[model samples]
Target: MLRDFSAQALFMGLLTAFVGFASSFAVVLHGLTGVGASEAQAASGVMALSISMGLCAIVLSAWTRLPVSIAWSTPGAALLASSGAVEGGFAAAVGGFLICAALIVVAGLWKPLGRMVAAIPATLANAMLAGVLIGLCFAPVKAVAFNPAFGLAILGAWAVVGAFNRLLAVPAALVAFALVLTFGIDIPDGAFSAIARDLLPRPEIVAPVFNLPGLVSIALPLFVVTMASQNIPGIAVLKVNQYEPNPGPLFAATGIFSFLSAPFGGHAVNLAAITAAMCAGEDAHADPRRRYWAAINAGVFYVVFGLLAGAVTAIVNLAPPILIQAVAGLALISAFAGSAMNAFKEAETREAAALTFLTTASGVSFGGISGAFWGLLAGGLVMGVGRFVAARKAKKV
Candidate 1:
């Protein structure tokens, strides 16, 4: 393993950590607060998620001898943001997180469970995700309307750097956001003192409150989004890089970590898709066999970064909420585009996918179940009818 260490691997690993953390922590912060977490609680959630994913990556890569990268469920966080405040508040949301983690664990241990999730229509899944992200994706524009100077600054940073390196675009925007916070926003008295106090996070164990609304709104949709968007795509990325590690254990490992972190305010952690490529690809190492070291190094960096999550939360809290949301929206644009493209990729499924996207984007809820779940269900029903009608026509012919 020592012999496998290389400068290229180390550098790529560091870059992966920086990009992954910088790119989306605002989303996590906004998601947590949207669901009723205090700044302290949200910071704890961020810290827990960061450390959990890092540990998951390190352990999985070591055990499987493959470049395995783990990440928090960014899509799931978006779902939470869309779902808004639940009945029992953040505690209930934590309960939902527990259920989602349990499902992921079952999906790994039980082949039937995994297959059932995999059987979901890709178009509907992508549509549902795109719908979930629509509100956040619009934040940048709204941010500009709210405050052009700050908002355009953030967008300009992303657009300029994005032209050269797509990977660094969000990070550049994050840097721009820090500048906005520093030079633009007026500081309140004692805000700096509070930030210094929160520089080190203290994880809080939340008591789970299970209810039907939380179960349907938070748990079910979160499980589907995390698995379909993050975990499965992560596996595909590894396979594309010619790694042959079994997917079951890797999924289970992430679920276990998510479960551990959920009690401490973290929503979910799972396999990485975007960052996995950096660790698994040739950029990490010429020898595919040696690329696991890159993931390991990334895992190390993640843990170090996790220690600073509280400070991040503290600093971000001082900014206007919409400005932070603008940063989140910028971070999610790429994900939104990819998902929207896939949602309507097939002509046969286009109508159903459109229905899913529209239903989810409406953000309507019934009996506490979120629009994401309803969107998928409605799309499935319509899709089923379309197939059935075609089948009957064929018989008549």
Candidate 2:
């Protein structure tokens, strides 16, 4: 393991963790608060998620000798953000998180269930994700309207960095945001002190309370999004890079950690999609056998980052909510683009995918259920009708 370590791999691993967290931490915070977590609880949630994913990455990489990066479910967070507060509030949300984690564990243990989850159409899944992202992606423009100076600076920084290295764009924008906050705007005298007080995150366990509405509305959608957007794509990423570790055990490991962390305010954890590529790809290491070190290093970095959750959360809270959201929107641009591309790529599924995207993007709520769940349902119905019509046409011909 010592011999396998290389400067390139170590750098790549740390870079992946830094970039991933900096880009998306806002979304995680927003998601937790959207579900009714207090500021402290949200900070705890971030810490729990970071530590859990970190441990998962470390253990999985060591056991499999593969670059198996784990991540908090970004799309799942987006789903929660859109879903808003349910009947029983944050406790209910915690219950839903537990349920989702249980589902993931079952999927890992049960072959047929895993197969069924895998059978979800890629177009529909991508469309659902795209729809969830559409509203959030508009935040930069909204930020410009709300606070022109700060907004423009943030957007400009993102644009400039993206022009060169897309991966660095959001992190660069975050830096620009910090600079603008420091020099461009006035800070309240005691604000920094308040932020400093929360520098070290303390876990706050919220007891889970299961209810039918939360189960259908939050749990099911969270499960679907995490599996479809994170887990399935994560496997594909590793497979593409010629690392085919067993999916079941990996899923089970994430599921277990997610379950353990949920009581402490964490949401879902799963195999990473984007960062997995960073660690698993050739850029991480020339020798595939040595690439596991990248994942290990990433895990270590993630744990350290988790320990700094308080500071990060405090910094984010210092900004206007819209600005934070704007940064998050910028972070999700690539995901939205990718989802849109795949959602419309197939002519046969285009209409269904469009229906899904529109429904999810609408942010509609009915009977306590989120637009994402309704969107997937509506899309599936359309897909079924399309298949039926195609079959009839074939018979007539």
Candidate 3:
């Protein structure tokens, strides 16, 4: 089989989807908590996000013959969670989301800004991106520490799958859940009730109302974080997969979709790196020309999921903890190591990167976003000052 349809390609695409599904749940949960949302509201939001990402991925993959996946802004959720109090709650988070979406749409329509983003040095962009993902992976590790058995089970499953079979490795999290269920892990009593509630018939509307204060506090930080963290890396994924994607249209579409769907529960949307990698690879389809089918399949799944938001959330709630933690930890390993690698690569810049890493790891917060934003700022400043000093010394000599 793989010889016929490109097993490697399929594996990559599936791996990407697995990561998106597993790691994103944390961010989604955070967003839901920030807003003090009802289970239904939270499900609706996730559903919108799933649909937006899935649809965007389908369009891009189909048109470009590349593996492309879309996802919600992870960094945006962090920003919302931190500054949620200031903005007065979930309503403000929604406002901030709308503003972020508008900015993306505007940027997409503006050629110069898009080109400038594209012109940034890949190394620096990647480094910045790595800084963003470091903490995301760490979050799951922290969760696991409090639940040793769950964590160990997840770890064991990951190790076994990774060592024994490459294909199994991507879906190991899903498998771990089955094991947990088999062993009769203690789950929340109302888990079944939640699941049943989600399955009930209902229309797809959330009655999103605008709040100026929330937009002001939430918008700028959310936009910057999304661009710096998710979109930049998403673009990088496309390049690595040999897809020279047009970032402008992609960003624009994501913005439009997010803006239109925000009331219905969608936030900022952007390209998906991990999932895109899989679709771009050869294994996703037998004919290179036909890989669009996978993307189309993803879109269909996303729309269905979005429409059934409640049920999906309930299902996620029921999923084994080990499955979530292990999958997130394993999938994010590459991102974590990559950030650390670049942070210390150059002797002259090492100090700056080190400062950035430490500050970010310290979990400092300022102006809504955390040290991930400040770490980049601090590193850039250090590098700038060092360069300026070096130039002056050379002139003096």
Give the best candidate by TM-score.
1
lDDT of 2 by residue, 70-132 (tens): 999998888888889999999999999999999999999999999998888889999999998
Candidate 3 residue-pair clash tally: 13
Query: Which has the better lDDT: candidate 1, or candidate 3?
Result: 1
The sequence of per-residue lDDT tens digits that candidate 3 reaches over residues 268-329 is 77776556656655666556555655555556566655666666566655665434544545
- List pairs with backbone clashes in candidate 1: none
Best by lDDT: 1
Q: 316, model 1: CA deviation in Å?
A: 0.2
How many residue-pair clashes does candidate 2 contain? 0
Better of 1 and 3 by TM-score: 1
Ranking by lDDT: 1, 2, 3
Q: Which ten residues in a row have the lowest lDDT in candidate 2?
A: 193-202
Off by over 4 Å in 1: none
Worst 10 residues of 3 by lDDT: 1-10
